[model samples]
Target: MTIPPCTESGSSVLDELKAALGSRVSTDGELLQNRAHDRSHHDWAPPLAVVEAASTADVSAALRICHEHHTPVVPRGSGTGLEGGANTTADSICLDVSAMNRVLTVAADDLYATVEAGVMKSALNAALPEHHLQFAAGPGVDATVGGMAATSASGTTAVHYGTMKENVLALTVVLADGSVITTGSTTKKTSAGYDLTHLFVGSEGTLGVITEATLTLHPIPASTKMGVWSCPSLQHAVELVVKALRSSLRLTRVELLDRVTVDALARYTGYTAPVTETLMVEFVGDRTEVESQYARFAGLAAQFEAAEHASTSDPAESSRLWQARHDALPAALALVPGSAPLPTDVCVPISRLPACILATQKDIAASGLVAPIVGHVGDGNFHVAILLPPGDERAREQAEELNARLVERALAAGGTCTGEHGVGLGKVSAMAMEHATALQTMRTIKASLDPRGILNPGKVLAAS
Candidate 1:
């Protein structure tokens, strides 16, 4: 659908929106330019205006105005998405909810918390420490709650605590028509009419704008231990991790970093470790149980000829190690200064992970791209940050082609095109191949809920 260029009628609609929203509406050129793109490699024309919604009522009003004016609306949070999910078009209104950052209620007794859409994951975790609880599922970065919910995000802790789809109990959403509705309840289990809460969890704001969320929290683990193992090769590292998963030991976090990624982390974060294929493992539980699990894992690693590179029980040291792992992308970018990162992720069955990653490594080597591999291999997911020179269209095409091949390999291996990152604008093409006939059902649902296609146009589904 071609979004019409803003005309005099659009100006009048903007004036009406300003009248209704007052100082909340902004036409600042600098801000508009900054909001035109996200952390992704994709860039678009600047949005016509930005509406910073501070409350559910503000979201309702903004959506109501945009719906009536036939204007496109792109819902956004912290703009930390790596898939261009929050990027806006030239004729659209960017509905930013970052200012709606507030924790409304914390039910420590019930192990749940109700927070506004814009609450940052780090901030929420910080607030939960006093209650001996935490919001377990996070996407590594300090992403907004609403954004995480919108993308069904999961990170290091997902292996144990589950993803957003499992943790979110309810959502307060504003529909495209400006109607407000609450889905699900705080109850643990309910034979409700429909699971609308999950339907919108990974909808990418194509159906409605998430305003608030009721999330389940977990008690902070009493004992946490982090360790890194260095393997002779990537194959050995992946094989050992798979073996550990099948064993009796329970691990909270299992991350794999290729040699290139390890080198990047060493230079960028000043972390000292053996420069080889590495597996970062963590165990959390009762002190005795944690230590038992660690010892069992050590034995398993030894069988694969892996050496213990580092181990720490101190909270500060463990945090530093994990932070370096999370900084893999930036570290990769630092390796090749003045280059853009085209990061992509894919997931396969645990048994096929070694083969998939090994083949991908070969492809990367042949393509001569500075793409480093890092992943939450415990769940069969990994990411490749393909770095390219700025404005190098030829190199970008080569990288995209390589990405397509990678997705094809995963799909053939009974895996998904994306593991954590939602299909914003980057992975839309893979939807049909990944979902097959189910793509039509998705389109039907999108049409039913957002008939006008005003919410986050050109995202997730094509021709939305």
Candidate 2:
């Protein structure tokens, strides 16, 4: 999808966009400033204009204008993505679909739900109970479905249900050329010619703009169980959680929080941190089965000489207990005022989690930086929320030391630098190291899809 070359008339291009989108388009300072960057907290960059798209047609129409103008477009959702995936380049435009929030369709029988790109996770979860169906997993799904699919995000539940790449059934995309394409179906399974469904899953809007999505959903768990396991150290907790995941119990989610992170959550959310480094485990099944699983799981944690085992079957109690797990990101971020959370993720084989986590802690100590570690430990993935002093160059410099070590340690432990977060701007350099020859293949794909390089200029692959 070659956008119109910049060599052409720029005024005509802006007019075309205005004619197509009318009131949906705006050059408002506030909206442009807001859309200029994502949750990345990078220096704000106001785009030339902002297009608050309302429908697929609106997106298509706006893209056509951007194409004609050869203007770069930053695809934005809730602006909740930590990475700078949605930062518009100077002179570019921001395509915000926040108004596209809608639950398009729900196939309860087939266990599927279709939603627009701008629908919030809480909104979808709210509507799921009517049919006893909900989206199973996404990248910490507090953001819109489109953003999650764009990044191919995964969270704790991804250990069991998989990530957006695994669950995204189909997408309605507006390409760089202003063409609309549907790549996959919402069916349970398919063996089609080209699996474009997976292609755009994590393209981060460089390849195309995702306007809508059809997603696979799962049944609401009949019964839910929660438990907190406290261990002497991070290594002990990781060891036991790894073992618990490998065992017979079907754990829906297992999140680990080191002592510092636990304390941060305690201070922010008013939830008491378990006395020791802890792993929060959740299981879902039939009422009786859930009880049996909880009992057996608690026994396993106890075997590790876990300092304590707190289990709850009550829904309200379970929500409160697990809120810390689900809300760890926002809650922990709140602990450090004015400073944005600089989170680095590393994913290694399950067996290496303890060593990787311990090494990370050591690196943090060496750097003399305080980092709160938390993440879905079920898949050997963990996040160290490095709270840097706002606008303090010295703190950021030190944080980079720990960040680089975090990557090195994960690679040394046979894990990836990132489990769910896409390599927007922050991880591109690391990705070059991780993918090696494979990185070239990704670049080729990007070039083939976006030869003119107008979609997103500096993301994933820099312009050649």
Candidate 3:
């Protein structure tokens, strides 16, 4: 866990960085330890130093110095990533960009906003209410926009609004050599050459550092109705979701919570619903349109033997309802006090969702693990939070085995190893199984962009 010193002449790279960036560079032991890991289960050795970059110039200067010394650089935002995409290695420098937060422009007429990478999603939405627009990409966490773009994050809204890949219009990225380039433009569509914007979207900082981004925005819906329905079984709930997706219903969000998750929510979040498979759905449109869609969705739910139905148009009630859904993880953790959570997600084609989820539930039952299943099922993505008792190696092994089996099942069903969570340190092993030859092409692109192999080394692809 010792950081190898990179020296220049008589002085070390750390000395040079300190001289160049002044107080912006810090070797504080506590800060280095704090910045070494993210919310992921994996932890790495403490970084050599942390560079708090307040502006694009600072990012360029830091990258320039790190590139020169061949020191690995890990770009970080708010450090809320569930994967270790922002985690730093022992010999690396953690480039903290959360200080660059700024909303540069709100083109309400054009339905887009230009923002610095460090701006949080909550802050952006707070500024957009008066404009009657909002950034539709919701990762359910107040994550930095740059981190969201790096992970191609998606959440409950992605079923209708699409993920970050579709919402990000342009990017200002600092290359490994400190050169900055802007990819894409404000134009909605372009038949331009290779789409470099998206190429870097999910690169996870292994290619370059994202300093700023232009994000596509959507008008606030005139009417939004939130509803929850308890179904007889998981199969019934998933069937209802599939039916709703195919029907004329304009669902803005569709989420599923299995019986176990519903029980946890009921106990922890005061969720008043039957302990059965449930669906939390949202409809957005004109009042009349939303009403019609709600009626249609209710009929579909009834066909699947859904019960204890609840609907709300009041903003406060709606927020409370979705808040319960977002608090699923914490509620699940309460199921096993003092247990750590190992969360994993996978996305499959909609048609195969029912079987996939049912199979996972069966696996959880057989594994004797207290894992709760919840998901954005409209697009066929679901998550399992496996709770492990503290320092229980047996439970950890069982959780890992369960995750491996679940991933293999998803891959066999034409799904990905990860849905919104990027292949940070957790899912790197699955990349070969999922992408095969395409992974090699990714390595080629990584080499082309970062020849020194210093950009967020040992992530996305294993360090060669």
The lDDT values for all models are: 0.91, 0.80, 0.89
Q: Residue 185 in model 2: shift from native, Å?
A: 1.7
Superposed by TM-score, candidate 1 places the C-alpha of residue 200 at a distance from the truth, in angstroms, of: 0.2
Checking candidate 3 for backbone clashes, the offending pairs are none
Tens digit per residue, CA lDDT, model 2, 1-464: 11223333555666777888888878766666667787665544677678889999998888877776778888889887776888776568788988999998988898778889999878888999989888878765478988899988888788879988888888899888788999888787888778998899989999999988888888888999888878877767777877777786788888887877778777877766574688888889899998898788778877777855567889999877877777776766676677777877879998888888777888888777668888688888888888886788888988877888788778777778688887788877787778777877888888777766778778877544
What stretches of model 2 exceed 4 Å from their correct place? 1-11, 326-337
RMSD of every prediction:
2.1, 3.3, 1.7
Q: Mind giving the per-residue lDDT tens digits that candidate 3 earns over 119-161? A: 9999999999999998989599889999999999999999889
Task: Output the lDDT of residue 80, model 1.
Answer: 88
- TM-score of each candidate structure, all chains considered together: 0.97, 0.94, 0.97
lDDT of 1 by residue, 239-318 (tens): 89888888966889999999999899889888788889899999999899999999999999989999998899999999
Q: By summed lDDT, which 10 consecutive residues of candidate 3 come out lowest?
A: 2-11
Segments of candidate 1 deviating more than 4 angstroms: 1-6
Q: What TM-score does model 2 achieve against the real structure?
A: 0.94
